[model samples]
Target: MADSDQSSTDSPVDSREDSIQDSKLDKFSEDEETLITMMFNLVGERWSLIAGRIPGRTAEEIKKYWTSKYSSSE
Candidate 1:
């Protein structure tokens, strides 16, 4: 019973560590993708313009979403 309790506590911490490592790995994988890099390079800095063109995408709305997203990830 004591062993099971210890394992349970460790399990969540291990899972969290794995998720953090996975996120870093995913970022590295994204860096290797040429097409995605190109699109991000072209449109990332100009969220407003992209938002304007895409239907249902408003500049302010996109800005807020991206801001929250990038902020949380960092």
Candidate 2:
């Protein structure tokens, strides 16, 4: 039915939005921050490598956190 089709299409979009919201709401813990620093020192901006070491984190999220915390604004 059309209603079922519409609901199925909406499900993916809703889940994607929920995941985005969840990622935004989540903060890096102290241990995660320490791990990120250590990984950066070892790999030097290889975000995917660092992300592989951290559970439940993506490379993009790691890079954004690192840049926001460490990169100068000049």
User: For this target, which candidate reaches the highest lDDT against the unseen true structure?
Assistant: 2
What TM-score would every model get versus the actual structure? 0.37, 0.67
Note the residue pairs that clash in candidate 2.
none
- Candidate 1 runs further than 4 Å off: 1-40, 72-74
Give the best candidate by TM-score: 2
Worst 10 residues of 2 by lDDT: 18-27
lDDT of candidates 1 onward, in order: 0.56, 0.87
Model 2, runs deviating above 4 Å: 1-26
Candidate 1 lDDT over residue span 1-74, tens digit each: 99999988998999999787545434433333343335447877576665555455455544554454455553
Q: Which ten residues in a row have the lowest lDDT in candidate 1?
A: 28-37
